[model samples]
Target: MPHTNPASPILQLRGAQVAYGQIQAVKGVDLDLFAGELVSLIGANGAGKTTTLNAIAGTLQLSGGSMSYGGDSIAGLPAHKRLRAGIALVPEGRGIFTRLTVEENLRMGAYTRKDKAEIEADMQRVYELLPRVKERLQQVAGTLSGGEQQMVAIGRALLSRPKLLLLDEPSMGLAPLIVEKIFEVIHTVMKQGVTVLLVEQNANLALGYSNRAYVMDGGKITISGSGQELLHDPKVREAYLGEIA
Candidate 1:
């Protein structure tokens, strides 16, 4: 059986807006990511999907409203400070350090931690989850295949031992097989008790993995519902689910 909770949200964005220069990429979106749930965000290319993730990660300031994590307002916190507050971002485009070795990238993820022993333990656990990363620990990131690079990116994020993991387009530019593998790894991570906020252009995969999903378009969220519910909605079928009939 699936899990259910009536508790407060672990992460909440209330009436948030994200702007770029003169363009408002995200307009007044409200969302809650509960503990032990995977919340997927899906939309078209320019629909502000990445912008919302950026806002939540503190890369982009909210033009309005507030963001809270675990009941503490994080609206004013910087990106690094948010990480220390237990938020980790596996950014879009698989933003790994191409020139650095895989082990070096993993070590960089632990930069904010002062507890050396715990960091080491988490690193080992990350390797256990991604044995492929362990094999390429000393290999330079630039030399790894695209799928391997994705693994490294996710492993690096997990090394931080964050309470909330933000994944933006984690399935982008990968083969179908690799995409399935990545989703499986995400499930494994969630099973270990981390909350997830997933943003993906591949709506089917995102909705399938998430317990609940939010659908965005033209800088606003137009719909929100259970993953399976959205998957079967007629409007969603015509729009994101890719059904013409």
Candidate 2:
């Protein structure tokens, strides 16, 4: 299991709800993430996992409920403010800048910061973590393979030095081997003191790397527990792990 601080969570959500016009996406969901822990939100397609993540990242405003980060209410904070406060989201579909070189895309992650020396240091660190990105630094981001683009996307997020990293469907549309590599990098991020909330469709893989996980169904959290607990759960097995009960 991943090590987690017993102190108050770095991120907390209570009775959170999000709506688009008359359609509600996330409903009354509560979650907590302690420092240095890797937590996952897993569900079937359209279960509101992505919406919940967006709410946390301040990309999608919550129609109801409250969110607190680092003990301060952030319901009114904008996405850029949230990013400055150490919240970074690597959205699904690998949102890389197609027109930019790989190096330029990575540099964009630090646009909020003026700390030139630290930024360069962080850039070096990212290169160490993702050497493949270094190899294609001058290459156009759009020309990279899916796996490489995903790597660049993650490296870009890490450049922000986030305290809370939100990843949505990182394993989607990648080869199995590449997916494994991505998860390995995520684990490394957690070990370096970043709290991670991952939204994944791969339940087994998510649970395997998670310290804890929540099961979302129809915009509500149906169950939550330690990773090992949910991994062996009969319901989780039957529904997500392709196991017959």
Query: Best TM-score goes to which candidate?
Result: 2
Full-model lDDT, candidate 2 = 0.95
Candidate 2, 172: how far from true, in Å? 0.5
lDDT of 1 at 230: 83
Q: List per-candidate RMSD values in Å.
A: 1.1, 0.9
Model 2, 11-58: lDDT tens digits are 999999999999999989999999989999999999999999999999
Candidate 1 residue lDDT tens string, 120-237: 8998898888899999999999999988999999999887889999999999999999999999999889888999999988898888888889999998889999888888888888
Q: Name the runs in model 2 displaced over 4 angstroms.
A: 2-4
* Per-model tally of clashing residue pairs: 0, 0
TM-score for every candidate vs. truth? Answer: 0.97, 0.98
The C-alpha lDDT values of all candidates are 0.90, 0.95
lDDT agreement of model 1 with the native: 0.90
